[model samples]
Target chain A: MTTNHTNHRTNSSGPPLIQCRRLTKTYKKGDNTITPLQELDLDVPTGDFLALMGPSGSGKTTLLNLIAGIDRPSGGNLIIGGTDISTLSRSKLADWRSVNVGYVFQLYNLVPVLTAYENVELPLLLHSMSAKDRHEKVQTAMQLVGIADRHDHYPRQLSGGQEQRVAIARAIVTDPTIIVGDEPTGDLDQESAQAIMDLMVQLCEDLGKTLIIVTHDAKSAAYAKRTLHLEKGRLIEAAVLAARRAPLVPQEA
Target chain B: MRLLPFAYAVRNLGRSPSRLFLSVAGAAMVVLLILVAGGFVNGMSRALRATGGEHNVILMGAGSEESVERSEIEAGVPGVLAASVAGVRTRAGVAYVSPEVHVMLPVRVGAAARTTTQSSGEQAAAAQGSNTASMSKPKGRQVMMRGVTPTAALVHESVSLTEGRWPVSGADEVLVGRMAATVLGVAEIDVQVGKAVMIDGRPWEVVGRFSAPGTVVEAEVWLPLADLMTATKRETISCVVLTLDPYNEETGEGADFGDIAAFTKTRPDLELVPMTEREYYGKLANFFGPIKIVAWVTAGLIAVGGLFGGLNTMYAAFASRIRELGTLQSIGYRRLAIVWSMIQESTLATAAGGLIACAVGVFMLDGLAVRFSMGAFGLMIDETVIGLGLLTGLALGVVGALPPAIRCLKPTIPVALKAV
Candidate 1:
């Protein structure tokens, strides 16, 4: 079956910011050659908020990592903003990711040694800007996530939800073209997870930033504009759930 | 590539205080070992190098140039050199010539109440025949004994009497070097002025103390030329040490070393070889090359052991931060940048240790006396040795951090992010 995303496309303001044609990823796990993704085609338009859902070993996070430019595709093309980052050199891809992609993690991976404000200012260090400019950008991002008062607190000092807020600030400080999250709310409590999902939705709706998140929680996936499911390294064509009521108690990986 | 903040590297070092301590201690030990080795080698080399006076020459029997102790030259050689060598240095019409006896003999420290020391069992065995055997037998250590006359001071210009008067001929008196205590395997106080030490089984009053700083002669025991000859019961002298004046171009008022060599050559009956004092001691330095190599090898091996310990510590350090490393990479940091930051962190710790080692070396180890076969010399922990130690510490930092950094960074970002 083919992926028909006419109804799933949330923003039609411009061409697709990310496109994957027959993308594949494989690795050797001991004697077994394991493929997590294969020949998958998908398109994510500008300002689109998409959620990828799957059980364990289904490649949802793998897809997110490729889109985040943190991993390379072994086969096919991964074009983001008209550039096939799959072919870029390791160093060039790092440069591209710095300017064009910001990523959040399931565990809210802020550097523990750094304070909240310093963590938020991290991605901005890659840019050639004055310290004053970086400070301003960091402050704005912190305020946007409503955690400006906790700027000096380290990740260990903040709660799970507050850590995620600081992480979101870090992702948005660069004003990148795409933001990807892998199980962003997987480690939070129910209320904290809801709060993190709300902040992420606000990021997409207000800033018009392209967002893709991999989640095992149906409640979290419901917050996205489009949701896709995968099984056995292939996308399930029938599970194109968009802004619909997801099943309660999603299977945990 | 954009670099990580120095604060990140600095702060990481404080994460585990125990690990930080271990790293610092390892570096300190490595650097301290290097300092010790450098001190030993430098002290020995300097002592040998400085013992030779630039304008001084030695007249030894031709077949015994290797060791002055075994050389037997005619007692009249000094007079023959003064009369034949036109460029010989002189003051008040007396030629600068010293007839000397060089011998190594068992010596006893007979000072009262001198008991335990950094004592050697072999020395105690050699001192078994002490006259008052029970309490007075501290130890008998072999010491270089030099017999020199009053004219000997003119030829050896570095020597100066620090206390008491010089030993006159046939007075059964001896002068001790500043490091004579170390050579005799006794405390510094044991060899003080007015004490008597047993040389060749006879008590000789220590009438004076002299120091030729940084030279091998500072370890020798000196007595009058006539006294040493009588005690050893040998008529011939060991060698004649003499000084030559640099010759003038136009007036030719003084002589060169070649003038002395030409005199020795003209008289086949003399059976003597003319060697500059510098050449003799310089050859001694070369003979001790193996000891220097052993010191360096010992230091290197210990450093390698420290490096391995540091490697294990650093590997555990960087390994625990695998996920953090992944997070940094995902935030657009290149792997090389992360490695650079890790090296910075490691180097800062080790450089601190190196600084501590240098301070200790300067304050505690510099000019510390050590006894050896020839005599004794002070450990020379000068600027050069300290510099070598610091460089060693810096190298430890860089070399220690590299493998662990690379290994921790080997995994892909996705794989690393999954690390526990």
Candidate 2:
């Protein structure tokens, strides 16, 4: 099938919050060179809920990671807000990530030893703030995610949906510029996945958060305003703005 | 920049009970070996240092300076040295000089027989008791036997009779040091005052018990010089010990080694070499240098084994948390911070173990007797040894955990998030 692989830019009314121009990521496995992402160009507008979707071995998660500043691009520029993050040193990037990005994982990768409240408060420790300020932020994040009652419970003591809620709380606690989730609902059930997706949607609509998530589930991607499909490290298709809140099908590229 | 909470690192240790146990136990074993090695060397060195007094000199045969037991000089050298050396201390018209005979001999307490003895001694043992042979297998512990006169107390002031009185000459009586039984491989009750100890195929009464505190002479058996000379059939004495007046530089009222050396040169016919007691024992201590090296090497190798054990445990621990570590990094915690947290966890476990080892050293290993050719000395588990033990344990934790922590944190966030 002939498909259009486009270098996407913002279609929103305002300037984009993230700009990726000719982004490339390559690594060596034994003797062969593997490029998980190659010359990928994308723009995410502010207050946008974007979802990245693709098959296994596609670069959806790779793109999410690159935007989150946890991984660097081998070629091209990644400018988030204003600074070119790809040029920043590793430690500097970490400082930027603390202030700018919050990442949620598929399995709700909360430290097993810490309580739900401590897990939510983890990122805030990187910032210099009074105990009262950190406590208030953590309380607000947990209450917003509706997991304030389970703050004292550890990961093992909580159910899967509750753990995911705590993870979402942790993601939003820092009030970062961008929140990235790599298969955030991949390990949850249908009801829990729907609840998590609803919470994420509220984060964008009410809090004006810019969220980029990588998911393989069509139902999960339906919550986002737009969804981009990647194939072999390239963008093959992108859904329209404010895509229907149902199982999404790709629009004609 | 930002660090994980101390509570976080501490709580991580309780995740796997078996791994924690392995880490703590391995650290304890390594630390214990280090403490033992340190104590042994410290005790040996202290014993040698205490055996020599700087103000005393030993005049032995010129060629036999290496060992007092091998040295032989004319019996009249003590009287001549006392008169010729102006620096020899004297009080009440008697010089602080002692002509002595030194020998290594077997000591049989009660019915027990010494392992190193002639066939006649064995026959004597057979006549004493049928169980003598069984008791004789001390493995092999021999003691230094020193022959001394009444004037010996004047120069060797550190020796003091703790129980009973000095041995009466010509009566086959002997004065035993407090540690004599330990060096003779016998029960303490067997060598108490009024008991009999067979030496040189004759029964000698243990009339007195003496102690020289930390010195090596505390392990010797002292008898009358005349009796020892007649029993060994020796025509010459082993050496003459002279206590010189303490050298005072400001007043020039005391004498130094040069004064003693001049006296030796005036009469080369005696073929005597003058050595400070400190130098003599220092040479003996140097003779055991290789043994100390072997001790440290063995400790180091075992410490390596403990390190590997620690590495294996930590690797397994961090392996299970690979995804969690990735999550932390994604939370904007730097790699160095994560590594630091891991080291904190490891050091806590090892530090606990180090404390246990140090406690054991203080309460049990301290002052434990160790036998050597010179005599027996107690293992000195002093502050320095304990300090070294604690430091080594900390180093073990830091060095052992670094590789595993770095390896676990190697996977990129995308790859790590996918780890099952």
Candidate 3:
């Protein structure tokens, strides 16, 4: 699944799915103003698996949020899927994101009261999909993440790994073009982290979907096709990583 | 967008069950207090208004209703005026006018004596002995007895015989309302069938027991005017009640009692002041106006406190869920929708509180009698009290919810997102 996403990114012609030129975000605290993201330039090509790595306060999450249209850049351009998201109104950007992007948070923000299936079906509520289609899509996403049997289990009832899988299902349930994860495996144990990362990479490669993961873990960064390092609100390096030790090619291929 | 805010709000509340319970309980207490206070005021007003004596207009001797106890006129004035009044409604050509005398007297039961020597020592001796025995024989029980003719029943529509028939002409029979009978610890047969009660040490045969339309009349005892006058032995007349001639529509028909009083002032033969039963009760209500005002003021102040408590709960609830609200906003829910959802939450909470209070109030307090003098009228909780209580709940929901909702929606997305 990972190889197919790398193949699509290597093949797409016109531009990257996410393009940021001189992006800056500033926060005012009392009398002092702090710049979180300063003149950062990055491009995330379609169907690419990119991992952003940085220390705390390095604006790694800010950059990912800007690309996902979850937060606005104080200055400069952010174009995601051909739309200048930085210039779009909050409401308009929200609409754009629901259709084009899905978010997976570190804490697995799965409304604890709702079952795995319902949590995965949350984002689809904004869409015009029929209930049957939504149900099928959610079921397929759950099955793909291998948590189909746990669909009725609440997040509190599931293991950290299973919950993250449900979170991943939710992220990709809409079949969004880009899936953004802010430390998706940060809260999981080693085995759970590996299982979640494996499922995520499988979904990316198998589904031809772009995945951006923000993480400080080198082992987690090792799974991505591209690793972008951020320092003090600016991109320090952008490079393609060596493929996972096990080649992602299907058994038939 | 539609589900996110509510989802988060509900989830956030669920996350901290203790806080949610505390807030809901606090809100419920406030709502309950408002409901009870509102019910109390309503009950008092109904009780006072109920004393209108069923549309019977009392004509005082050239003074006010408050002054009626001190005022007097010729005993034969009612009969003479009944014959001459221009608009008196008649049944079989007999004017439905009856002269009545009202006086408050101290009544005692069992061994309690009202004599000055016995009363002075009674309090000290009773206090030294058992309190229950002293309480059982209440000292100087103030009972308002009305001296009335048989026609008094016609004038006061609420009067009804539950036992023996109305006093036979010239018979020494007395009737009492149900509440009065209950308070006096005498059954309908004791007051109605053929028993007798003491009036100034004279035993008057009880002829009938009656129930009035409202609670105030229930506290009164009725006796034949001549017998009551004979028992007391010094009465001229307290007041005269007369109906106007029904045929003289132009001159006296539909004449307001106040206007009739003014017209009567011009005549030298009679010095009378007239007022409708309602107006008379209104004047009586004036006596308790200050007490009512104080009650309302206290309730209003407490209500404001309760409102603040409710507002605080809602504000805290909304504030803690800013992240969820931002999530909704980012998912395309309008600011108005978020605001509306918060309002709905508040309304729902307060409405639940109101319903609890109402159920508690109805089950425990409805038809509960609270007897206090509002001048001549005696005010209890009734249907009106319940209606006001429910209305108060609705008003609390509206007034307490709107302000916080507006504040919640005013913050921009970036600010709201950062709130968490």
The whole-model lDDT of each prediction reads 0.89, 0.87, 0.70
Native-to-model Cα distance after best TM-score fit, residue A239 in candidate 1, in Å: 5.9
Segments of candidate 3 deviating more than 4 angstroms: A1-12, A238-253, B1-29, B32-56, B65-67, B92-94, B108-138, B164-174, B181-208, B226-233, B245-266, B286-293, B315-339, B375-420
Q: Write the per-residue lDDT of candidate 3 for residues B1-420, one digit (tens) a residue.
A: 444436544555565666556555655666566555655566556656766654357787765557566768788778766755555667886677878888776544333443433544566676766455435544545677788877877777666777776765456666766766445543334454566555664345667777765546777778777776777775589888765433345563643454456556766577777777666766766776787778778877877888887777777767776765665564445666667666656665666666776677667755544445421222234466556656666676667767876777677654565565
By TM-score, the better pick of 2 and 3 is 2
- Those runs of model 2 whose alpha carbons end farther than 4 Å from true positions after fitting are A1-7, A238-253, B114-140, B247-253
Model 2 TM-score? 0.92
User: How would you encode candidate 2's per-residue C-alpha lDDT over B1-420 as one tens digit per residue?
Assistant: 799998899999999988998898899999999999999999898889888876899999989999999999999888888877786788998998999999988777754543434434666767865655545554334679899998888888888899999898899999998888778777889899998887776689999999888788989999999999988899899999899997788877667888888878888998999999999999998998898889999999999989988999999999998888888988999999999999999999999899999999999999887888898888898999999999999998999899999999999866776677
**Model with the higher TM-score, candidate 1 or 2:** 1
On TM-score, the stronger of 1 and 3 is 1
True-vs-predicted CA distance for residue A88, candidate 2, Å: 1.7
All candidates: DockQ: 0.75, 0.77, 0.26
Sort candidate 3 into its docking category: acceptable
lDDT digits (tens) for residues B45-144 of candidate 1: 9999999989999989989999999999989888877887788888999889999999998888845223322123335776755434454455478899
TM-score of chain A of each: 0.90, 0.91, 0.88
Best by TM-score, which number? Answer: 1
Best-to-worst ranking by DockQ: 2, 1, 3
Residues A1-253 of candidate 1 have per-residue lDDT tens digits of: 3342223322465768888888899989999999999878888988888999987998888889999989999898998999999999999989998999989888999999999999999899899999999999999999999999998898999998999999999999999999999999999999999999999999888899999999999999999988888776777764443323456677799
Query: How good is the docking of model 2, by CAPRI class?
Result: medium
Identify the leading candidate in terms of lDDT: 1
Clashing pairs in 1: B87-B255
What range of 10 consecutive residues in model 3 chain B has the weakest lDDT sum? B373-382
